[model samples]
Target: MLLNLYGIYGNFPLGKNDMIDNATQFGAAVASARKALGLTQRELALAINSGERFIVDLEAGKPTAQLGKALAAAKVVGLRLTATGTPQA
Candidate 1:
């Protein structure tokens, strides 16, 4: 059984409740999840209707990466996201 840095097991379910403090960290997590799923950057990009460069830039932690596309990539790789914060009224 392979154990990843995020405590993922053989099935490579990816991170759980991982805190992403910045775009770079989120990109890293997305890359990890993509690799765990045995998906190439191009494959992930195609799946999300994006160009390979998008995946490359995203995985490289480009802060300007579009949120919608990035989120789509993350979702395709099974990276579940849960936003938590105090709601501003």
Candidate 2:
């Protein structure tokens, strides 16, 4: 099912499968949140103390991005990472 998230960016879809399962999803979510906040990629990078190229790579969903930097960027963009349910055996 699809959920609608209403925030400063208005309303956006939030589906169950929309979870950030990989770099591509992470990038898309970051980009969506950033745009919703009316921020440019460079602006977000600066806010997170990262480089513009890093932001570009991040938005492009590059899996090799530094974990620290990626987490920082997510925080700046108001993206929170959370895990639900128990681990599979």
Candidate 3:
């Protein structure tokens, strides 16, 4: 159900200027990808060196979740974001 919100395999192909728009959208992507990769929230937290609670909050779309850790979790699950028109670093 959640995966379908993004894609069958939870892979979203964004256009050059596409944006996630909000924390909930970003969280959904993260959750979908994590599941698609056969990971539980606690497992993902361990993999990202974060607390299980943090993963729960993140997947629940908690807007106050720390950005750096959130990005790290996303990275561990192979989710990426793009800022349109920004130069790659």
Say which candidate scores most in lDDT: 1
Q: Which candidate number has the best TM-score?
A: 1
TM-score of every candidate relative to the true structure: 0.80, 0.76, 0.74
Provide backbone clash counts, one per model: 0, 0, 0
Candidate 1 lDDT over residue span 21-89, tens digit each? 677877888888888888999999999999999999999899999999998987787776666665556
| C-alpha lDDT (0 to 100) for residue 4 of candidate 3 | 21
> What's the TM for model 1?
0.80
Cα TM-score of candidate 3? 0.74
Cα lDDT, model 2, residue 56: 92
By lDDT, rank the candidates, best first.
Answer: 1, 3, 2
Clashing pairs in 3: none
Q: 49-71 in candidate 3: lDDT tens per residue?
A: 88999999998899999999998
| lDDT for each residue of candidate 2 in 1-89, tens digit (9 for 90 to 100) | 22222223333444433455678777777788888778999999899887899989988999999989988887776666666556666
